[model samples]
Target: MGVDIGGTKILAAVVTPQGEILAREKRATVAEEGPEAVISRLIGAIEAALSLAGTEPARLAAIGIAVAGMALPGEGVVAFSPNLRGWRDVPLRDIVARQLGVSTFLINDASAAALGEHCYGAGRGVNNLVYVTVGTGIGGGVIIDGKLYCGACGVAGEVGHMTIDVDGPRCNCGNFGCLEALASGTAVAREAKRHVAEGAETCLPQLVGGELEMITAETVFQAAQKGDPLALEIIAQAASYLGIGLANLVNLFNPELIIVGGGLAHMGNMLLSPALRVIRERAFEVPAQAVRLVTAQLGGSSGVLGAVAFALQQEAEVRP
Candidate 1:
């Protein structure tokens, strides 16, 4: 079984080698209820998925969890997390291992998604790949020589947090001018609200009735699709920043492919077209030609499937 424990939701699923989802379920994290409550919700999700899959206890091999924060092996503690509150020194792996008597592997969500795509999705045949996600925040994962690269301190491929501008907006992670703070879904929503408050005539402003509360990323995307020039500008700027970020990744890693995922990627070619243009225009020739940037193929299942695959790989290594 595999679990994706994010700030707002928990997704549990039984996945197969062929990327098939046998069964799955999800629930909100409800962090306001505290750490124990979040753990209970995670446990409920696992049991529900197991029941839905009709898998006997003996047949279940292992469990993998994709978490949102920084993690270290053997400790099972989330050292730092901007989204999940009161999660310091939390023994996550130990809790799951003791409660279920199953070997549990923990991986960050972005890294897991990269592994999943490399193993079964767009980067299956590629020796090197980077999966970048633009959503509530920006995130990325790196795969080198067909292996996930956690780097020193298990924090590699954190391209989103990389400083893009010295005087840019502040990020939730306390960084200034990160690509995420500039171009994330949340960032776009904020920009929409700012334009509305500034009396910019936009469908986004009218759709939210001049209130910033209901202006979400989805709404902005819809407005852009309907030819709202302001909304289109916002998305283009985001894609431009995303493109620059990718170009930097290309220059640094020289990967064979780059897979974009998350809600923004759902904009499809509309967003990718501008991003590709910016990347080609900015990136060096050799790295640019070697890279093929594409959308994520597995859709939303990448995290859970990647978690399962990570566990399976660990088990495979232990046997011989």
Candidate 2:
């Protein structure tokens, strides 16, 4: 069993060792009800999957959880999650393990996604690879020697927080010039709103009825598809920044492949083309040419499947 506890939703799954979802369920996190209520929702989701799969409690070996936060291994506490509001140091692993009566563990969602990709997606057969998710925010995870890599403090591949410009827009991470500040979904919305405020003519204003508050990444993507120059410019700028950050990763890790996932990646070659062009231009030719970058195969389900695979790997380690 595995769960991906997202800010607004929970995805629960019974998965096999190969990252296949035998059964799965998704439900709202309802986090506004606080930690206890959120826990109940998580359990409900798991029970739903179990019911769907006809699996008994004793049949389950272990449970894995993937969450987004600044978490330390063996701590089971959510240090901080901007997406999950009013949360700090919540004892998540203890709560789940106590309620479910199973061996349980939690991992960062990005790392879990990386594991999923490495085991079942573009990273298959590669000992070294990276997973880059460009969604509401930019996140990354690293795999080395056929295993997930967690940094010394466990928040290893927080590539989104890397500073690219010292005086750029302020980021929610309380930092200026972070790559995410310039390239995340929030950045796209901000850029679109600014352009609208400047009286730029586009279908976005009409689509949102002239309310800049209605500006969003989805709307910007739509506008770009409609050939709105301003929206296209914003996306291009974001792609450029993404390329710069990827160039850094390529130089540092020399991974065999880099898998791009999340909503922004759905733009397909539109979003990937510029970033790929920039990464190739900036990174050293030897390693750059060797590294293959592609979009992720599994969609939203990757995190939960990866978490399950992680638990299975742990179980195998303890046996024999």
The whole-model C-alpha lDDT of candidate 2 against the native structure comes to 0.85
Alpha carbon lDDT of each predicted model: 0.86, 0.85
**What are the models' TM-scores?**
0.96, 0.96
Q: In candidate 1, what residue range of length 10 has the lowest lDDT sum?
A: 71-80
Against the true structure, what is every candidate's RMSD?
A: 1.4, 1.4
lDDT of 1: 0.86
Please give, for residues 1-320, the per-residue lDDT of candidate 1 as tens digits. 88998889999998776778899998999877767889899989999998999984457788888888876544666665666778877888889888988888888888888989988888998989999988999888999998889887776778799888889999988889999988899989988888888888789867777667999988999999999999999889888888888889989899989999988889988789888888899999989988888999887788898888888887787674
Per-residue lDDT tens digits for candidate 2, residues 74-164, read: 6877787887777788888888888888888778898888888888777889999989988888888999888888878777999899998
Which 10 consecutive residues of model 2 have the lowest summed lDDT? 68-77
